[model samples]
Target: MKRRDCLKAGLTLPLLPLVQKAAAATGPRPAAGLTRVRPGAAGWPGTSDWDQLSRAVGGRLSVPVSPFLGDAATRSEALAQLRNPFFIGDQPALTQTSGYHGAWLSRPSARVVSAANSADVAAAVNFARRHRLRLVVKGGGHSYHGTSCAPDSLLVWTRAMNQVELHDAFVAQGAAAGTAAQPAVSVGAGAMWIDAYNAVTTHGGRYVQGGGCTSVGVTGLVTGGGFGSFSKAFGTAAASLIEAEVVTADGRVRVVNADQEPDLFWALKGGCAGSFGVVTRMTLRTHALPDTFGGVSLKVRADSDESWHALVVETLRFCRDTLCNPHWGEQLRFGDERTLGVSMVFQGLSQDAAAAAWGPFVAWLAARPQYTLLDPLQALALPARHMWDADFFRRHAPHLIAEDTRPDAPRMRMLWKGDQSQVGWYLHGYASAWMPSGLLDDAQREAAATAICAAAAHMPVELHCNKGLFGAPADALAASRATATHPAVLDAFALALIGNAGGPAYAGSGGTVDEADAREGAARVQRAYQQLRTLLPAAPTYVSECDYFQRDWQQSFWGPNYPRLLAAKRRYDPEGLFVIHHGVGSEDWSADGFERRR
Candidate 1:
């Protein structure tokens, strides 16, 4: 089955009907005493009416859609001219455009506006408030559970809000302040990591809170717990936050930070996903930039069978265990490749010593005589750059790139889904894919090894240790912060290249892995996370991994901070006129009814 088919199967869970009924009972009930707030419909409006909404919002919204999402002649045209709005239908291509490699576009109920400025976001929020409508906020559209954008729900796109503000040595100022009085940055929610990186780096090698993927949005990434390469050396992205500027559901603009709206400030840091409000900008602490060493590429073959897998798996496990050691600054990416190479970067250690320290892993791969490591730095002399501003995205995209592209392989088909596991050890289960059948176990593994060798023939598998992937130290960030409630959350990215997946455009790559193959690949990943949990026994928890897993809004992402968030919501949005998809504040029921009336 294709990945979409498996995901579609997920919609058919036995308890789906019961879940829907239960949701209807307590889901987004009509606000008490508020005639304006009506029960929202379950799904989005039809696709044909999308343009009417685009025209309705008019210049108030900023999105990529060119008035063609609803009237395009072909799928490509529709996708090319797509932008988000409440009445707009879901764009399948844009669904999976999130930070996590695993998370992909499933289907949304409706589209929302992508803001270019704070006023634009304010307009959307206020509009929702006036209409008693539900809203969803998207920054980089990278949430694992597709929480950022909702179908039928009024969506707020922060992409147009991408702006980087650089200040003096101490702090980088953004247009949107976390609070009215505090000195913070006011960033457009849509800005990507690379944007921030360039802004900071251009101004005297300064550093700000960001993550590994250059394309991830600052708003959603920080709110959902930003993790990146510099994290272990620095801290989780949220810890560096000084303030946030947000547009409340009731269309009120508030600044949240340590001093002003302190409770809301606490909520905004890690606790605020799409709930509290639309984060238009943030003021983040700045760090002096440091000279670092790293690389991004793919490694395929190793001398022996056990050595290649062991080198990849064990090296990853070791890196995870020793992340806080201070001497190592690393990120990893391993897939259907051999001898995955680590893009090793070290700041605390000397250059010569860092290379020597990484020598053991290198020697291990070298022992695999059959393994042919294609070091990009050695071959093409490409220097390792940080994930934030690297030139990888434009080159590889949808799926192929310099890191793992095969020239003669079949076209690649990729499906990405995200999960967080609490496992700490790494393990392998080669027997599962061919299990039950066990027909060509030996021959298959060998062929697999050959393929691995072939892929690595061009470039080595570079371990891009996604910085800040793990939630911040719970003790340091506090439960009041968003990530504190959801500790050990790691972004698991699953990517594959297959034939005929991208239609006829780039089908000549010759590398193709279909749905069944992808499932097997995912199973391999599951086993890896599960076994790693045994070793470290502290892997991140993925909401989709378990059947009973439900994103309770307050608990899974916010934890014990729900009461405080609810209190803030009540104070800011008394009428409950503005609600959001997922579990946001929809379940709260104060005695006098929902709070905040505009």
Candidate 2:
């Protein structure tokens, strides 16, 4: 075959264009370095030889996948297509299950599947089912553990299945004074939270959910319990769900809602990472539109460690006690310095009311006279409107301080390993213990804070808890556990590591030493987390992206619902299809932790 054809067949290494062009521009070569494999036409595992897999899936999927198979320029063209087919130059390098927040390297068995619509997803699911394949569901590719993409599994990518349908009745309708259900919109599982937000606003409606980052996928956030600034005004992204269309393991599609499939509906809402099924679409009750007033409030600096610590504690205390009780939105963010910032929002209200609601904290900041505080609302300027005011401060602080002087700041990768529970004061108890730890001395603390500040100066850490959205009905969250699934629910803390892009590379470092250091760092983090675990009203589990291989993960994410989930799995995915890599029905897990029938 021609070199371009070989490229189309999944030779992803960046090659010299001249060599490929000369070969393809001229004629086919007898042999090239490329290993030809064709598992399936769509590039799923277990279908064909690697060499011929591209043509098979390309032919089947019926998209311009060949562009991905060709030479440098041709493959680049194909990748571009994959990014955003609706918009030009949006396709990204679709690595099978890689590119998670903190994932540095992925195992070699990685593969990719791109779905253009729900039909394609059905086909993908069927393919995996027939082949008895282990699958990973990819929506936005942002999970820290990269759960959507797995190392040793067939990846069912859903990024291409983007669609949104809004409902006017749901937005306008209210809970009947006596008994009534609100109207809701139907959204494709692949849609981003921002898309839903825009749709709700455009339709003259509003949605109350916690979606910290606009780019986060609605499916993952909603199903996993989304938290955001608007959460206080609303409830949780999960709470707004009126219904959802999910694809079960048996390749059967079903609509789950409170009144429809009560158990499954209950499981779908905060049931843990993914126990019930692969959600293809969601029906969400939309609220009335409200004018949102929010921005970043600033004035904390790097040099003042004591002042910074006080501010962070005060802010957290204020939100947990003062703000959460009043149903107001507020978030406190601290960077690697003496810097303190806040992102507060008031839905459907004017700036004055918001100012008054935030009066106590504002007054405290002003009276302290320790640092300069700016009006976050006023500091926000146009032309750079993409960012909120709080984010702007995070980015600018780096330039203010000389990079060389910020040595103590450890510019390391950031990975988030967090969980939610009925316990509202989890952080309150944990923070007290962590502050005095010898992790950072006075000077080191200052330097580290500076480093964090510098990094925030680029991409600010989004404090999404402005909504005080945690502590859903403990009984409801607990009810998800029906059996002993691999990952249990209570222990399931959705974890993601936000690694710094283009940060540290251990190129020349001794391999053993670097590995040991990483292990040490990981251990330190684990220890600290264990300390925090003490505060859990109960021993809530910590779910890591890397924990996919563990059999316990199912039980951890699913909690008490594991048994019923397995029965449903037997009924739906008897052959074990449509499983999430690190999820309940995943085939990668050994049968060690499953509850046996007596």
RMSD to true structure for each model, in Å? 11.9, 15.9
lDDT of 2 by residue, 485-593 (tens): 2222222211211112221121111111244444443444344333333332122232322222223444334444444544444444443344444554443243221
Q: lDDT at 118 for candidate 1? A: 71
Please give, for residues 4-105, the per-residue lDDT of candidate 1 as tens digits. 100000011123343344334433444444432323443333444445445555654333332223343544443332222111222222433221113323
* lDDT values for all models: 0.43, 0.42
Clashes found in each candidate (C-alpha, N, C closer than 3 A): 91, 75
* Model 2: ten consecutive residues of lowest lDDT: 1-10
Which sections of candidate 1 miss by over 4 Å?
Answer: 1-58, 61-93, 96-116, 169-185, 296-323, 333-340, 346-351, 364-598
Q: Each model's TM-score, in the order given?
A: 0.59, 0.60
lDDT for 267 (candidate 1): 64
Please state the error at residue 480 of candidate 2 in Å: 12
Worst 10 residues of 1 by lDDT: 4-13
Q: Model 1 lDDT vs. the true structure?
A: 0.43
